[model samples]
Target: MFASVFVVILGLLYCRKGSSQSFLGRPRLYGPSEALAKEVVYFKCEVPDYAGDEEIYLQLFKVGDRNRSLGGYTSLRGEVGAIPKVIKPSHEGYLECVVSAQNNSGITPTVSHPHYLKVIDPVKGAEIIHSDPMEFYEGNALQLQCQLSAGTHVSYKWLLNGQPVSQSPVHYAADNLLRIDRTSSKDSGSYMCMATNTFNKTTVFSSNSSEVVVTIKDFVSSPNIAFTVLKEDSQNYSAVVTCESTRGTPPITFSLYNRTELVTNMTTDDRQATFKVPLVLDRHLGWLQCQANNGERIAYSDWLPLEVVPAGGPVTMHYDFDLGENYAIVGLRFYCKVKKGSHLRYQWFLNKTLLQDRGSFYYVANEAPKQSILLLSVGRSSTGTYHCEVSDSFDNTTAISSKKHYLDKDVLNRLPILLVAVVFGCFTALILLVSICCCIGVMFRRRQYGEKSLLNLEMDTMRAAYEGDLDLSVYNEDPDVVNAARGDEFDHASEASVDE
Candidate 1:
């Protein structure tokens, strides 16, 4: 029984080896069945229970061209199953692979199902296809298309003025076509189309179409004017007036009007025109309007009223001081008067030198129309001529005081000397007049006393001769002696009076 069991075990082992060999006769390829051009493909034919050590071969060929082998491998064995085959297909078509196995007994081969490969080339060119009408009008429907000559799976994108044409309520983009429900002047620009291969989005292979200029024609509308005031004063005003149309074509001319007459005419190749109105007067203050013309249509702006008033006169300046005073002393006040001006500016000058407001010696006392006074704490250096200048802020018209007043060394210094000189002169004249009156009185008195004195002297001499000793008696006795004595007395009296 033991011998019988051994023989049975050997028979079962042979049956198992035969079953494995039968399955190896047909090998199945295991790899990617579909590939692209220039794509590396790896494949291996697998056989169940076959050792890796074997003589095997692999062959690759296109379908329906079995005679022309694209590639192949040699010296493959069943122990090695089927050698892995690597291939890179150059063209797009169906491809097939065959694996052959060889051993000491024989050789067997098996073919795999065909593999489909796809190759792609980028888009080479693109163009914007024109519609029926080359020109568009405002509020009109329009459509544009992009035409491309490219490989499979190509896509299109539209651009306007180098920006993407996005879908909106009025614009629609479907596939390679763009539609506009309503067009306007804003839609007038260069339109372009771009074609790209979607198969390789990362490769960035795209073609741009030639720019197509779309002209949009429309009537001028929404006429309006804008004003920028450059300068404003009481007399005149300067401004920049601009006329514009919200929607219009180029070559538009603008005309500015004051009341009914045209003031200026301007031509522009744009939608708007600007004019600089310089030194506009009160007469130019009426209703102003502007119009725009584009050789086909004319649009007018609403009337804008402009008003200007007259400016004030130049500044007039004057100096006020005490006329009776000879010199300005310490604690003296003077005034600068500014008149006939608006927005006046004041400056004080001392002997042609600018005087600062802040100083210890001088300061502004009362700044009023009547005053504008300058007070001084007199110093030796304060003795100089002073004047003031006034200017109008608006017109820059300046005026300086005609009278320049001055301070001098103290008034007291020369006043006493002058008073003394005047008093001395008057006293001298009074003395001379009194002396003339005295001389006249003396002459008259001398004449009157001369006669009276003669009589009085004779009486006195006779009295003396009687009262005295012999001399009196002798004078009373003799008339001649008495007359002589009287004469002598008269002479003495007259001489004495003359001397007095």
Candidate 2:
């Protein structure tokens, strides 16, 4: 009985010893590496459960500041424990987790490896900025910067046309800045920036900057000038001149010149501009030329030769129609012409009212002085009888009017053919009249030659019969000598007749 009691005591001692054992391995601390200031941070501590029935307590604190605990979690079941703490800028530093178990053997502590908590300030109100001239020419350098109101550990990237821009030979992207070494037309687009911290990659922070438009302009190219003569006279010439550049940016300044004299200049947002130029003979207008300037460069067009042709003669008017599908008349064209005139001024009268610039409904194109056109929309006041008055630009009083004619496409089509036939008949009659005049002239010359030959023969016979010391060849060569010989013979014949 004493031996059995001693064995029971040994078993009880072993059970007490086993109940006081400590945790086996160190605790593992898990948390975010970086966190925004004034944000809630969670730390998890996982400890090995050596004695399952023991109470476990975990503490999270900075490594160097072991005196004060940041947060704590307790578990009676000895499971994974988590603690949350409000992290501030002051809380940025190294942190660690310590877990302890309390049992019959008192408390045992196991510390985890140090963890780094980098508290950061989020970026806000990001924007893109640029300075100096807003417009850049080709081959010019461009620079832009990303700016933020408040941030920490900030990084920047550039975006163009909503796509991420990578570094290239001509394009450069660095922290907070983007640059183009040499700008071109293709480089023109919208530019933006994104400013963020490393935490934004996995966090809810965003710092996209507002977009800024970047413009790259093209240099002005050599210009060319073209002109259509509207009217001309002995004193003045009028034309519509166009100045153009094949390739260039807008807001171009175009200047028209008559030799060295500047006639006019215009500033337009397009690459081409038109000017109405009127030249005078007294001023001695020379060749017309044009110049284009885009603030970066200047170009000039080749000289254009311009001359004046005076207007003259019988004025006539004809009509034609621009037909659409199904032979529908969409537009009407009235042509006023002068048979022998150039640089003529033309005016059209509908009933009696003058049609001067009646909005877009009417267009007047005097391509040449001899031929002026009045184009009209079919339904826009194109009805009624039409007559055209024309004259030289120098003299309006000499203007002549053509007979009024009602416009009917079907009737006018046959009118042109009839007019052509009439013109042909007049030309043929002129040729016939010239031939008849030539025949009459030949007959008169032959009759005069026969009379002179008969007179010369009569003089030769009289000289031979009389045998006088005078040269009868003088009578044939000189008409006055032959006339005197004829008078003497006629007087002798009168005497002989009187005696008979």
Report how far residue 336 has shifted in candidate 2, in Å.
2.2
Best by lDDT: 2
Tens-place lDDT per residue, model 1, 246-316, is 87776778899988999898887778888877646444566779888876668889997664333333333
Off by over 4 Å in 1: 1-124, 132-142, 183-189, 198-206, 215-249, 257-264, 270-286, 295-297, 305-308, 311-500
Highest TM-score, which number?
2
Taking all chains together, each candidate's TM-score versus the true structure is 0.34, 0.45
Per-residue lDDT over 1-500 for candidate 2, one digit per residue giving the tens place of the 0 to 100 score: 99999999999987766555444468899999888887897889987645567677789989978899999998787778889998877788889998776443355577999998888888888998888465779998898888888777777878889988878899989888888898888788888898877564676455998788888899888888876555355444667889999888888999998899999999999999999877553243579899999999889999987654445566788777787867677788888887765456788888876878454567878766548888877663566778888876656766888889776545533447778999999999999999999999999999999999999999999878786666565446577878999999999999999999
What's the C-alpha lDDT at position 223 in model 1? 62
